[model samples]
Target: MQRKLAAIIAGDVVGYSRLMAEDEAQTYSELRAALREIVEPAVQRHGGRTFKYTGDGFLTAFGSVNAALEAAIDIQRGFGTCPLDLRLGLNLGDVIEEDGDIFGDGVNVANRLQAMAEPGTIYASASVVRSADKEHVARFRRIGRRQAKNIPEAIEVYAMHPDKAAPNGLARLLPARRLSWSRPRPTVLASICAGILVTGFIAAGSWTERAAAPPAAGSTSGSLRATAADSRPTVAVLPFDDLSAEPSQTYFADGLTEDVIANLARNRELMVIARNSTFALGDQPADIREIGERLGAQYVVEGSARRAGDQLRVVAQLIDARSGTHLWSHSYDQRIEDVFAVQADLTARIVSSLVSYVRQSEAAAAVARPTADLRAYDLVLRARGHHKHGGADRAALLEARDLYGRAVELDPRYATARAYLGLTYISEQFGWPTADAAELVARGLAEAREAIRLEPDLPLAYQVLSFGLAASGEYEGSMRAAQRAVELNGSDPDSLMALAKAQLRFGAYDEAVENAERARRLHPLAPEYYAYIHGQALYAAGRLEEADEVLAECTLRAPQDPDCLKIRAAVLVGLERPDEARAAMTELLRREPDFSLAGEEVGRRFGNSPLMRRFLSDLSRAEAPPSAA
Candidate 1:
């Protein structure tokens, strides 16, 4: 049979080996199913033919590039739930009746292009894209050009999203690493707590009402419209993996990781993952797609770190997390103090390479707020400064508050801390301070005000305001604060999640469920927030079965958690399982009797929240309950 000119398409899993090692059967089953469901029918619709499955991936050919691009879009739209994502590359070339398979530079180009395309995306060289006539084809947005092995000069490249096959709505996601504020030495945390005292509760002059306008902030709306990377090639620095013999060295490696995060955070073109989220991946291998989805990242920077003697070596690799392949890898050798400088050098190199590879006007728009006053390390230090103080110690929070205050003081524009400090003030009222209700409310508002004034764009700041307002009995005011936070960072799983939880405090059940679903989709492994939001929402809505399942998942994720155990008691009672409910309450009382008292007090704000009401009622009626006695 004579063969005509065909557009060749090639794509394979980027880190199949790593994925397999972690989960073999699950990965293969999903991949095969995706191919059958999404891949085959897609190219067939485009007048294309799919041969056999190559070992790890597959090969396909189309008569026209337009058909191929359309086929790619169909596949993405068809299969979005699979664990592993695909990367596709297409080229125009010829194939002959040689062996049972196909050959030529077109196939080779597509194969190599697969290596270049971001995961869950399609990429094509100019040679291939130009072949598709505009009338016959969809959209195409050029992301960059690449120098092919045998081709002369660089090949222009365009990327097409699955749904936006025509290429008019191209967007990006980012994955990144954050440094933990923990120390190798536990006692050191105690000293930090002791040094920092209760300035967390200074009173704010006023609190906004429900109808008051939201503060002017950067972007947190979660909408792709204001991604801030408009023309600039955006990137993400993923969390670093620890590879040390001693587990304690995890902190040291984490410290270096923060160094990288800080080094890159300074580059406005790049989007660094917040530390709170990054540390969530400690020692756990993550699917690249999952990472990209969670952080809303376009690129993922990852590496491992180890410390030997006075010398340290950190190995880092940049991955198109969307694709899950090792794009570039290098090692850094440095002394402890010099480690910070090495991160700066690496960032400059990676960014320069992106500039060279990309033809976009720039990497990202002028989106980063300025932070000139505080040394970046202090930010990292504060995160650890508070958490390291084991449990409900006031000293640690005080230190954290001071560090956060100084951070905002030094850089009035440092929005991240402004959000965190607001949370601190609200947390202080959780019995962490001796302040009365009026004192606590005033102080929490003040901290929230300062935070928003510094970073009006910070979703977390808005979230804190929600928490503060709700606790102080400003029901409607808290609701607006939660909504504003959502608008600021709708794309951020954490932000969406916090807003959802806060909405529960205001009796907004529908909005709460919607945000929780969004948050769960973006970051499926969110340990704390995911469980709390949906479980509480379901409980509030009287969906006892759904609430039970959600709480069960929370227990599976964190079996030892007292809060998870306690929350389940209310669900059990709703299901007419009082004995089970008593068991759950018994577990809760064992951990902290005072929890019951707070639950009782908090129940008034959240009507129909069975968990809080029962926990409070159970404790109040029980002779053995410590809080009542």
Candidate 2:
């Protein structure tokens, strides 16, 4: 048995047996279904290992105390307003492993902690508290003392108050970092970092840095110009509130944000947060510094939109995340039909003032859509939301696909529809029965490119092209399309995430990690997919220990995931626990007999060759494997 100190976690349904007795069939069904959907995935996301799947609950193992607390919080959040509740217990100490089940005082303490906990609460021992660097950030308060059965001493406990406080460690920090909305003094330090980051990569063998992000640039400025710490460039774009009651005015607001995003991206000398990340924070009043720090930016852009009959109004502001000062402010009122012209003209002016030598190719695409396509364009925007922003189970994608289909049917030459259709294909692949990865994907991608040809100026064309390319495994091509998409709309988190994944897959390991870190910060609640890039980045950097921890997390955190189980097997093998590794492998093989050792591949897919290398090296190191042989 491997002797190791670990964090043990115990959780159980608040009233499982009683609920069952009340309505055995319905209650059991709901509990089972919810456990699989919400509880299990949350545990995995918070980096917990499943030691046992209780008939109605779970006994989890975590290596890090912080991770254990996080898992509990996530479980609460994932339930999302549901009345279901869970009780949690956690302790950090040495535990003996026997046939994969843990033993000793640590496990006992963990179980006791849960048994004493109230419904919907996480109770952790003092040992777990001391291990945390930022436990206070989660608003977990000391809960006096308790005596556990057979425990030598009384233990101090802590409980998370998720309802009263922000549920995440980082989200808790959001209130303090406000951005100004009326001034115009944008910093350019981030742009320097951006430049240095890009310039560092002009090589045939470009991807060099592996462990951490660009070594903090000793570190490079986001604007790519090295500077003293006091002066750095950063920006954030706030969500534009729609003031119109009809809700139809949303497009005008969304369009404004998109336009501003382009204006920001055009500043080659400045670092910019991708729009998707910024808009994510716009829905609520957020701490700009926290948002900027996480988004990897120095400034923020925020605004609201309203329409009264033919007149449309948009109030926009850009704020410095660090200083909480507004760098610029403006308001526009125009006819609804003229909103397109408003975005184009405003973007053009903002560019002429802030950026010199605006690219002609971009300028051409910035033109407002013709008045004839106004109503149809709204459907396109709605389709965009459905196709991209929505999650795996979001039904909106079907409606989006159909709408885009109709939009093109109504206008055969509409390049946007073609690109959108391509985007929809990528969305459909997330589900098994509804998934059509081959034929539909090919046609969708072809249409994306045709959209580009027909509408070279539209960012959506590039965005769709990027997603199609990535979905098709054209990693390098996808990176190019994604890069172009961001160049066209730097504030779009979706584009950056797409770009980040492409870079990770194509061996641009360093850049991939940097961009992915940025994307994760902007969209912390990224449904399940966030773990993919985060876990891969850890693995690529040879952080196998950490990667194993994260991979185990994916197993439950990501609902209905094929790769979660597969990834666990791969990372365990990397950690040299062949027994645990094989167990994971056996489970995967049950799901897929053709499963290969290539799962060990970090940046690249490992085939039989890497497997042979690993097998030989491992056997050479293990006296038992040889003695048995």
410 in model 2: Cα distance from truth in Å?
Answer: 4.0
lDDT tens string, model 1, 494-520?
556666766676677766666665555
Off by over 4 Å in 2: 1-232, 247-252, 286-296, 345-372, 433-436, 457-463, 466-493, 499-527, 546-565, 578-629
- In order of listing, the candidates' clash counts read 31, 50
Q: What TM-score does candidate 1 get on C-alpha atoms?
A: 0.49
Our tally of clashes for model 1 stands at 31
Residue 187 local lDDT, model 1: 33
TM-score of 2: 0.51
Against the true structure, what is each candidate's TM-score? 0.49, 0.51
lDDT string, candidate 2, 407-474, tens digits = 77767667767777777776565333244567666777788888888866456778777666655667
